[model samples]
Target: GSKVVITSVPRVMVEGFLKEYLSVGHVIGTELHTFGCYFTGFLTSSGLVVRHRALDDYFGDRKPDIGIGTSSLYDHLFISSCKVSLNLGPMF
Candidate 1:
């Protein structure tokens, strides 16, 4: 089976929905601050997650098979990196 990964939303926020509804296998989102099994609803020390950087880290040297997103600004960065990309936006 092809691995489906979504890496733009906060993991703690949309992980369940993505998995259940979208059948997403992996999600790389903003890391929330946690203490002893408690979420702080705050970003981690590393700060806000950069989309392009995250994509580079996730893919390394292997370009992804596909990239899909709604945002043109942030999503466009990685979408172009994939072999195939779909921008679900009005402009696209």
Candidate 2:
């Protein structure tokens, strides 16, 4: 079983959907703005995360074993950095 790291999605949202089979052990995403128990629906000062940069920050000098993402231009750079990548197309 390979480790799955999710980047570029809201941490709260990913946390809810990630399950045991997904093997998602790490995440890099925008931090939420919150007041007490209430969410502001806004990101923290860091703002929205750039997927490729977040991926770089997560792995540092080492590249990830695999990258899986949608078949969109947005994911091109992120997917290219990995040792192997899968573009799951629109259904993804």
Model 1 CA deviation exceeding 4 Å by range: 1-4, 21-23, 35-37
RMSD of 2: 2.2
In model 2, state the lDDT of residue 33: 94
- Against the unseen true structure, what C-alpha lDDT does each candidate score? 0.77, 0.77
Which residue pairs show backbone clashes in model 2?
none
Off by over 4 Å in 2: 1-4, 19-21
Q: How many backbone overlaps does candidate 2 show? A: 0
lDDT of 2 at 13: 74
Q: Give the per-residue lDDT digits (tens) of candidate 1, residues 1-92.
A: 45656464567898888788988787778888998899988888877777778878877998888887766677878788889988898565
Give model 1's TM-score versus the native structure.
0.75
